[model samples]
Target: MEEETDTEEEKLLKRQRRERKELQAKIQGMKNAVPKNDKKRRKQLTEDVARLEAEMDERHQQEVEHLRLEISKQVEVESLANGIGKLECEDGEKTAQHSRPTKAQKRRDKKAALEKEREERIAEAEIENLSGVRHLENQKLGHVLAGRGLQIKQIPSDGHCMYRAVEDQLKERGSMLTLAQLRSQTAQYMQGHVDDFLPFLITPSTGDVYTPEEFEKYCDDIVNTPAWGGQLELRALSHILQTPIEVVQADSSPIVVGEEYSSKPVILVYMRHAYGLGEHYNSVEELKDRTTEIG
Candidate 1:
């Protein structure tokens, strides 16, 4: 009967601990979900969370008492069984000696102790640490962008069942912006500079050179990203950011370099004005430094 009571108490304590652990995990999840800005809502959630934790601790304390009772019951059972002759050896020898714990068992116990201490230390540190609180910076940044009306509802930019994002700024604020305006805005947005990236202007027409920055941005954003092939030796003539002046054919055609020609590499800048300026630039650096204002 005592053994049975001990078993029941042990089981009950185990169940109580399990329930407390689950409550702890749940409270943690709710804390994560509640935003810092929503003070009233956060306060309510926090109070409820606190209540849950208090209840869990209360239950756990009760479980500890139950566990103590269980141990006592087990001890009593062992004493009663020892009182019975059936438990004793018929041919009694000297009591077997208890060997010291193995090195592995000792190490495992030490590891467990250390882990418990570390967890306690972390919890204490969390109490002292204000910066451990996550303000959800990424989501805040997203909201900032959204507030600026940068969010354009994705719509199909093509016949395929796919949606392409047109910047809200582009559709509304920049609706009347020219190529120059577009280029300047992108440069300002990205690098706080007044440069432009015009990727479709120069080709076998202007006979101008390319800049390294222009080449990289074109590859990163357009050629590698959009995967537009066949247009080899793409050059930028513009000094601005996004709206780079690129070298396209006379009719703004995509030029296939090797298949189009071999030895005589005829490079063209898109604008006739750019071709007019070609005689002005002696080298690549000169072209990059040259900012033209067409009369």
Candidate 2:
């Protein structure tokens, strides 16, 4: 009968601890869901959580007191014998081991959590650093180009910068051509004139010449994916638009890649050692004629 009573008391204590844990979880959920801007709702949630916390604390105190009283009764029944006292102390130590984390365990858990947070912050800082670099590079380019009668308009840096820059230049010239359409047209031109591009499209990774199959796959990526453009795409676009493509670099003279076989003229502005990376292109436009007009 005594053993059965002890088992029932242990089960009751376990249930009380489980209930307290559940209450703690609910309180945390309510706190998170309550928005700071909603003053009335936030206050209501705060009060509810506080009330639940108070009840949990009171229950915990009652359980602790009950356990103390039971231990005292057992001590008296055993006539304060050393064996009974040692057994009780051992049981108490076991309970402490199960319920409380050791200092070293707590430190390890805290260290792991802090390491994860540091990695997340570092990732964010890297992205911000890249953006700042791009912004500074643009300012420097604008300062140099303003001396001439031109300034560069920034385009989206998503591997599609080349296509977007060309599109921007065309838009200024009163033509509305989407990047996708231009990509498709350029791919078709290259496919029709394989001999011109096939030699250059040699597999860079393997140092082997491009097979007809590999060339087709590469063309597909240019048209469908967000792959970047290079001299080859510029040449294809020039042929398709039937215009000369002029790229003005920072260190060298203007590099004209396509023939001026048609009436349309396209000028591309490029900056070397820009954005702390490779060369990048921007759309060039002429400022309004201010030589004759007075301020």
Candidate of highest TM-score: 2
* TM-score against truth, every candidate: 0.25, 0.54
lDDT by residue (146-170, candidate 2, tens digit) is 6666767767655577788899889
Off by over 4 Å in 1: 1-21, 86-295
Residue 62 shift from truth in candidate 2, angstroms: 65
Residue 251 deviation, candidate 1, in Å?
72
Instruction: Please provide, for model 1 over 156-200, each residue's C-alpha lDDT reduced to its tens digit, 9 standing for 90 to 100.
Output: 211110101112223332445443333333333333321332322
Q: Show pairs that collide, candidate 2.
A: none
Residue 269 shift from truth in candidate 1, angstroms:
79
